[model samples]
Structure formats: structure tokens, C-alpha cells
Target: MGEVLWENIIVSILAFAILYFLLNKYAFGKLFAIMEQRRELVVSQLDEASKTREQAHVYVEEQKQALNQARQEAHEIIERSKQTSNKQAEQILELAKEEADRIKVDAVREIESEKTKAVAELRGEIGSVSVKIAEKLIEREVKNDQAQEELVDQYLKEVGGRS
Candidate 1:
């Protein structure tokens, strides 16, 4: 009975060795090749995903920089507009002041011209009245034109000097 048991143990070990050798030579090689292909595919996919993530990060940073630059440009435009408007306002005010000064000068000149016209009219009226009064007082018409003109001139000088 002991010898049969020993023989059965040896036969079982020998069958296990043959099965392991066959599987290593045929099944294991194909299985390992498939597993290696799957591993390489997963690694390539992961590398591609990492590269995509890096590109996405770079794009986001570029967009952020562009947004900031746009904002800065907008701010500069606003500042320039403000300065331009301020200059325009100052120019408008200066033009208004110059126009007002011109108008004031024109008004002054017109007033002086009118005053001179009024004074000349008053002198003429005074000279005519003096001539009429002299004719009435003397009870005669003055005959010499030169004498009458000289008399009127003298009277006008006296009156002008007094007032």
C-alpha cells in the first residue's frame, strides 16, 4: 500500500510539471503579448490625455492674458478719451471767451460812434437856434455868410469850453 501511494504522488507531480510547461510555452506567451499590448495602449492614452491637459492649461493662460490686455487697452482708450474731451472743453471755453471779447469791443466801438453822431447833431441844432435867435434879436437877416459862420464858430467854442 505504501508503494502505490508513492507512485501516485510522483505521477501527480509529473502531470503538473507537464501542464505548467505547456501553458508557459503556448498560452502564457500569447496572454502576455495581449496584456502588454493593452498596457501600451493605456499608457499611450494616458500620455495623450496628459498632453491635452497641458495644452488646455496653456490655452487658458493665453486667454487670460488676452483678456487682461484687452482690459488694459480699454482703460487706455478711456483715459485718452477723457484727456481729449478735456482739451476740447478747454478749447471751447477759450473760443467762447475770445468771441465774448470781440463782441464787447464791437459794442464799445458802436457806442462811441453813436455818441459822436449824437454830439454832431446837437452841435448843428445849437448853431441853427443861435442863428435864429440872433436874427430875431437884431431884427435883421445877417447878410455876410463868412461873418455868420465865424460868429457861430465863436459861440460854439465858448459853449464847448464851458461844458
Candidate 2:
């Protein structure tokens, strides 16, 4: 009975030791290796994500700078267009002023010329009428050619002065 008990205890200890060694070598060690691989993968993934975030931030800033440049260019274009329009308007105003001045000058010249022509024509007509009237008056008063010519000349001078 003593030998049998001693044998059972020894066998039990050996079986437990063999099972612990097999679990450490096969299942537990593999599980530890898998955990390490998973930890390394997670850390590498996190690093990649950080780099991507930084790149995205830089790209966004670049886009913002481009937008600012576009805005400045648009403002410049608008200012240039405004200046062009103002210049055109000034040119039009200048042309209008010149045209009006030219028209006024032409009108004044035409009026002066017409006035001169009318005055000359009126004086000529008056002189002829006066000469005829004086000749008739002298013919009735003197009944002589020399007296008629003198009277006509005097009356023509008087009519020219009145005119």
C-alpha cells in the first residue's frame, strides 16, 4: 500500500510538469508572439496616421494660399477694368466738350458772315433807291442835267451816312 501511494504521487507530479512545459512551448508562447505582432502593427498604423494628418494640414494651407492669390488677382482685374472705364468716360466727355465748342464756333462765324452780307446788300439797295429818288426830285425842281447829277450825288452821301 505504501509503494502504490508513492507511485501515484510521483506519476501525478510528472504529468503536471509535462503539461506545463507543453503549454509554455506551444500555446502560451505563440499567444505572446501574436500579441507582440499586433502591438507593433497598431503602433506603425498610428505613426502612418499622424504623418497623413500632417500632410493633409499642409495641403489645406496650400489651398488657402492659392485662394488668397486668386482673390488678389481678381481685385487687380477689377481695379484695372474700373480704370479703363473711367478713362473711356473721360475721353467721351472730352470729345463731347470739343464737339460743342466746335459747333458754337461754327455757329458764331456763320452768324457774323450772314450779318455782313445782309448789311452790304441792304446798303446797296438803299443807295440805288436814293439815287433814283434824287434824280426825279432834281428833274422836277431844276430841269437841268448838271443840277440833277449834283443833287443825286449829295443825296447818295446822306443815305450812306444814315445807313
All models: lDDT?
0.89, 0.89
Candidate 1, residues 52-96, lDDT tens digits: the string is 999999999999999999999999999999999999999999999
Query: Total clashes, candidate 2?
Result: 0
Give the clashing residue pairs of candidate 2, or none.
none
TM-score of candidate 2 versus the correct structure, residues matched by position: 0.69
Q: Estimate each model's TM-score.
A: 0.75, 0.69
Error of 1 at 111 (Å): 1.1
Candidate 2 deviant stretches above 4 angstroms = 1-17, 142-163
Q: What's the distance in Å from true for residue 96, model 2?
A: 0.7
lDDT for residue 31 in candidate 1, whole number 0-100: 99
Q: How does residue 43 of candidate 2 score in lDDT?
A: 100
Instruction: State, as a TM-score between 0 and 1, how close model 1 is to the true structure.
Output: 0.75
